[model samples]
Target chain A: MKLLLKKGRLLDPTLGIDFIGDLLIEEGKIKGFGREIEISEKDLEIIDCRGKLVFPGLVDIHVHLREPGEEWKEDIESGTRAALYGGVLRVACMPNTKPVNDAPEVTSYILKRAREKASVKVYPIAAITKGQEGKELAEFGRLKKAGAVAVSDDGKWVADSSLMKRALLYAKNFDLPVISHCEDPKLSFRGQINEGKLSARLGLKGIPASAETVAVVRDLLLARETGTPLHLAHLSVKENLPFLRWAKEEGIPFTAETCPHYFTFTEKEVEGYNTNAKVNPPLRTEEDVEAIKEALKEGLIEVIASDHAPHSPLEKEVEFELASFGMIGVQFLLPLSFNLVREGLLSELKLLQYLITNPSKVLKIEPPSFKEGAPAEVVIFDPEERYLVTEDFIQSKSKNTPLLGRELKGRVKTVILEKRIIHL
Target chain B: MRHLLDIYSLSSETIKEILELSENLKEILERPIPKVPTLRGKLVLLLFYEPSTRTKFSFERACKVLSADTMSFSAKGSSLEKGETILDTVKNLYALGVNLVVIRHNLSGTPHFLAKHLKIPVVNAGDGIHEHPTQALLDMLTVKEKLGTLAGLKVAIVGDIKHSRVAHSDILGFQKMGSTVYVTGPAHLLPEPKEAEFFEIRPGGFKICYKMEEALRDADVVIALRIQRERHGEPFIPTLQEYAENFGLTPRHLELIKEGALLMHPGPINWGVELSYEMEKYPFQVILEQVENGVAVRMAVLLRLLSGD
Candidate 1:
């Protein structure tokens, strides 16, 4: 099968290309095109990218598809559909499912299901330990061989430094990056949201920002000593941004990503309905958001990932203490990032670089770029349209988008993955 | 439909009818066909802005037992996302034909807001510090179930007197049942138990053991409010160390009180804070008994409010 995207302005942030070109595709790879005449429209199927700006498809390194053990909420099929609608072609899923991706079998199980179901490229990041229990390390080499792109103990961190160091050292042999969810569960202290005045008044427990930064400081040190590649997932707390930037300067082989919700809202938004705004590492203060924004602009943070954890509506419909921590976020990431970029917080090119090229570099999976001969994994978007979010706007089975009823600008027009237009 | 919004909405006459219906429902639970078609054709909406395992889950379980469909929506996933002003979110829930709103918001006037907007009756599970009227009704049901009467008895509500909405709503419900209500706690915690023209305060702090002893000595029923652990941060009591020493319920506490005084507590008890673990298991503890009665009383409230009698 063949597909052609005609006369689209290729905005290649990595190569600095901003000119009109035809994206020629055969099977699932980009053959060649642009200056040379391409195949006829009737000879092959064509997508009219006439006035659209085509860029490398966005990728999210953090999303929770809540599959394997719990398909009632969201499986690979539904979650990839959401990523497709939001202009994401590749995603690194969290290993927080019921039967976590700790073993090669579990990782292979997710990859096998994705092949049969998902429309987008689903990269299964295996758990660092069995069931993410933070105990003994799994077979790192075996897991990587069984189609696992990276490894992470995502929802909560591996508390033992000694154990985490061993896992990091073990992963180096396979050249697999060890992604970490840097948080000290002990520092959470049974708190729900951020530690502040609102938590005191709401009478719920508060998790301190130091709970996160303390872990990042420790893990970064560990990565430096072990000479292992560490990727921090959902890096919240302003203090960690400087540490991450410093790590790169020192050549510590440390990289990090932050979610849209961390930049969009804060502890203040948790006044009434405590659960939705209630996530682990908790939402930080406004100062934290400002710090994260500055990092994005200064190129300290590498990529933006949607720590998209979807809980059943029943579990979240109660008091703050009883509700689960996490909300479905893939359906809103692109629009939200666009809102940030349009607000002068980040340049369009810088934002897309994190969405595309930077994530590709971290995962070591090259998404087909806008080069003359490459696969046509492209995202077509318009940064001008404005829209309101509602229940109907969500594509995931779980209705946990914190963006509901939020009116915002910029919508993902269409998303193409592996020469197939998954969203139109 | 599913929620029991408030107690006052049920009149003195209608209240009796609902209690009898609860008795009938209890008998049905014992029989093979525990299922009821009362809410079979409808949908029950369990919406709690506040947390409630018993009231919320029991309502859901009741909906299941009745063979009725149910759906739950917390503030997290709903319209509370767009900020509160332009999005009440309840209208959309109502448009979906939600038969009831079992609301428990932290704000004092939230359920009343639903009452004003929706034609479907609301079951006010609990609203901020204002009232948890159904909880009061359930405590009364528990008393009547065990003692076989609620009239002409002295019932004392002790502990966390200032913040317990359960204690606030119970005084009124108990008074309507012809019981003389007495409210006493640490001096900083209690209000003079309000009864129209009468008022009386408990003397001194938790140090004043004589006052609480006197209050519980002649009581036929004793309701101890659950003291929140968050209050340990408050300057009011001086310290949890001081409060536990004086007010902590112990075996001595149960012995000093009247033998016939039925003991109770609203649960998720802090084993060492206001009440003891022994008090939780005490024959008079009746805390677990309260949880069971909660379901029955809630069934009564749902029947009366939804039947529109």
Candidate 2:
């Protein structure tokens, strides 16, 4: 297969390149990309990319593809398809599925399913604790050998400090990255949204910022003490910032991640008890959103992840307190994150780095690139495009989002992954 | 007009309209024959998931006054005990040609959930610790009857503001009517103002007065909320005795307020817990008046919703 993308402004932050160019792909490999490309080969496909911005396909390190158990909500095939439509070509799925991915067999099962059914690349992050109970550490070496890229207890935090320290040390020994969910369950007990005056008025129990910050502090301290590389996932509140800064200044090996929802929405989204906006480390205050945006701009926060938790109406269409805590986000990852650049907080290249390069670096994977011999994984988008975020537009099976019926800027126009092409 | 889920969404004008309607309904309640033909053919269902006597009776009596037939469902022997969802149960009610549902559940936003699912009108009798719109309206009605108007009154709500749905609704209701609400209780018992702001009742206007003396000082009205015994679970309050002594209203505390400041309680009040037992029959006490106003206020709500106003 040979293809040519012509006259698009290519942005490859990895290659330090941002210019109007033509990219050539032959047999699933990037042959070349430059201001002018000479093609001698006949029978080559061409994609006219006029008035478009092209970048290496986005990489999202946090997504929950509820396979091996909860396929009704989402599976590898549907999740990867949603990610593909969102311009995300690589996804590292959390290991919180039922019959949890704490064992090598589950990790291998995910990889095998991805190989057979996924539209995009899928990396499985196995559970740090066996069954994610936070009691005993899993076989890190075995999980890594079985195709797990990282280990995390993403849904439940490793509440036991000594146990978490041992897991971090063990992961370091095995050269696997440790991801902490960072929540003190005790403080978050029966909590529904961000602890504040709103929760008091709404009468929904609140999960205070201290629940996250206290846990984050403990994990950062453990990471520093144990000398393990830790990746914090789906950080929401401003309270986590000072500690994150302290950790960074103290030369702690850590990468903090926040999702698009953290920057795009606030605790007010849960008003009228809209369960679709309900999520763990619940959408925070405006100050937190501002701080998160500033952290992204200042590079204090290194990665932007989807943290795409999917749930059916069975989980959401009930009373607010009874409803499950999550919203489907895999499909909105790129479009929402693009708001950072559109708002002039970060350049397009810098934003793309958070979406693509930084996540790859955190997981220690081969970064998606627009260089020769690299896989031709690319996404073409129009930042000027605006569309109503209707249920029909969502590729995921679950249409649970606060953004439903709302207008959102930026849309992915095309995706080229190796030998395949998907047009939106 | 579609639903009375909570007081948070009602504007000040709408609140006055409800109060005025309640005032008109109060005349009907005093009539020898109390029944009205307003909702002659309507079927209203009383779906109470939580145990309630006053709210349930108030709603039932209001439905009777409006000439609407009522069917009651308590969670104890109902299919809800058999694991039937609130939606499924409400769907069953709707299938029975029920025109409206007056639901009281122990979960916040249960009415919102039903309103989203059901086509018929839904009135929130009470939903968990979220809000009791009619109760707030009735409290406002009592205030209006005693003070001539709700505006320009300093309304102090004392007791478990954190857990009392009445406090949540009353604060919003009073604030909407240009009344400055001072919510006083123990720091643990006092609700965080975030919930108040969710109703667009911002701070500075609405005060969280942890000191009862300060909250009661020169207050035009003081409504004592029932201190829920279950909320006594620690770190919340050390003991009921401590809560009653420190935050509870007494005859001595009453002197701190305006000379004729009306004292109110959303009863089934725990006597001697939130207010002294001696103040129960005090001339300024409007606890009984609140009950009467509850039925009147609920009648107005039912009539408004059924009339599609």
Candidate 3:
């Protein structure tokens, strides 16, 4: 099958292509993308993408596809569908799902399920520790052999420094990257929201920023000592900035990431006991958000991923202290991140690099490109389409987010993965 | 007009309106029948999620005094445990033709949540440590009845300001009426100024007193809040003895206040802990007047909310 996307503003940060062009696809492979592509084949399909921005499909390294258990919240099929709606073509599923992806069999099972049902590519991130108990390390070689892209005990931070050091060094031996959740359990125990005056006023216990920064410092030191590739996930606090800066200056083999919420919302969202705004490493202050944006612009924070942890109403519609952490964002990830461009904080190319290229680099995969012979995975989006984010707009099974009822600035128009084309 | 969720949002005009109505309602409470036909056909539902005998009875009495038939729903073992959300429960009540809901939830902003969905008025009896608007109003009414005016008064709220919703609403309510509010407790029990400032209605703002004497200094009204016993484990106060000895209202401490300063305490008080036992009988301690004013103030609030005046 041949497919054609005509007259779109092609934006491939990986190939440094930014021009009005036509992208041609033949047999699920990119034929070419440039100005006025010479295509005279009578059987070729054409799509007019005028006034649309086309780019390589986004790659998000942090998403929770709650399969093997808790399918009621989200499964691989539903999660990837949500991702596709946001112009994401690939996602690395976190291993905090039911039964936990701690074994090679579970990792293989996830991949098999993804292969059969997922709308977009799914990279199963296996747990670094057996059952994510933070007690014993999992078999890294076997997990890697089973097609796990990376290893993380994501929902729970690996608290023991010695165990974390061993996990990082052992994963390094298997050429696998170690991702740290970066939180101190002791400091954050029973914490409902950000530790500040807001929590104090709401009569809710607070999770201090030191809960993340202390853990970040520990993992960075261990990563330096072990010479293993380490990626910090969903950094929300400005206090982590100095430590991350020092690590980069010292040439430490580590990369830090921040989710869209870290830059978009502040602890003020948690006011009035809004459970949708409740998340782990709780939404921080405006100063921290500004710092996160500055870090991303300066390239100190290199990747942006949707830490899209979905929960059913059973978990979300409760008292503030009782409600579970996390707000689903896989579907709105692209539109929310586009605000960085609207604010002149990041160029379109730089934002795409963070969304597409940097995530691929973090997972050690070849960045999705618009080059010839590459698989035809692309997205067409309208950067200026304004729409109210209602529950029906979400493709995910769960609608737990503060963004609901908000008028968001961008919208995904279409997604092309392999031979399939989905229009939204 | 739709709900009394918190005193912070209540306009000075609306607050004065509620207070003035309560002054008239006080005369009705003094009458033998103590009942009115104002809301004879209306229905009021008391949905108490937490165990609160005093607040529930207060609202019930207020509804009865206004001739509104009242029903109470204790959420201790209801459909709420069967995974029913607070919204669903309130919606079910609304469907049942209830005129207004008096909600005392353990979570802050629950009445606000109910008010957003329900067409009927919602009155916040108390919501977590966030606010207790009526209690603040009744306290203010009691003070105004005794102290002439609230504008130039110096009001001090003592004990567990961080955990007391009454203290939060009272501080904001009293400050809004042009009174300077002073708050004092152990550093841990005293609210952080930022949280207090968020709810402040006036520019002059409120004060956080380091010493109990500092809070009591020339105060026209002194309000005591119950030091929550559940907070005992966290070392907020090392011991009840230590708390009472250092911060509790004793006769000796009364000397620091103005000669005729009115004393207030929202009932179900931790007797002898926040207030001295003998001080309860003191002429200045208007604890019972606070209770009497509660019914009158709630009657006024129900009338204003239901009548939409």
lDDT of each: 0.73, 0.88, 0.87
Off by over 4 Å in 1: A1-7, A20-22, A26-28, A32-51, B1-309
lDDT (Cα, 0-100) at A4 in candidate 2: 93
B114 Cα displacement, candidate 3 (Å):
1.9
Clashing residue pairs in candidate 3, if any?
Answer: none
Residues A1-424, candidate 1, lDDT per residue (tens digit)?
Answer: 7777788766777776667787777776766557434675565878777777778878888989887898888999999988887888788887878788878788888998999999788998888988888899988888888988988898879999999999999997898889988889877756677765444333345576788999999999999999998898887788887787888888998778888988988887676544567787688888999999888888788788888888776666554565788888887888788767767987777788888888878888875476656766778876667788877777788887566788866677877666466555
lDDT of 2 by residue, B1-309 (tens): 788888877888888998999899899999999988989889999998888889999999999988999999988988877888888888988999899999998888899889988998899988888889999999988888888987788988888888889988988898888888998887766765555565447455588776788888999999988876663334676777987788778888867999889999888877888887888767888888889888999999988888872
Mark the regions of model 2 whose C-alpha exceeds 4 Å error after superposition.
B193-204, B229-235, B281-283
Per-residue CA lDDT of candidate 3, range A41-99, in tens? 87888889999999999999999989989999999999999999999899999999879
| Model 1 C-alpha lDDT versus the unseen true structure | 0.73
Candidate order by TM-score, highest to lowest? 2, 3, 1
User: What is the per-residue lDDT of model 1 for residues B1-309, given as tens digits with 9 covering 90 to 100?
Assistant: 333444433454554555566666776566687677776667778877766777787777667666668888787876777665211477777788877667777654456556655678777777665468778877877788788887777787777755566876676567666677776668756642222121221222111122777667677888776774443344566777677777776678666566767887776566687776666667766777677666666666666666663
For candidate 2, the TM-score is 0.94
lDDT for residue A379 in candidate 2, whole number 0-100: 95
Sort candidate 3 into its docking category. Answer: acceptable
Question: Evaluated with TM-score, which candidate comes out highest?
Answer: 2
Which candidate tops DockQ?
2
* Cα lDDT, model 1, residue B5: 46
Residue lDDT tens for model 2, A326-386: 8888888988998898789999899988998889998998899988999889999988898
Q: Scoring model 1 with DockQ, what do you get?
A: 0.04
Q: What lDDT score goes with residue B96 in model 3?
A: 87
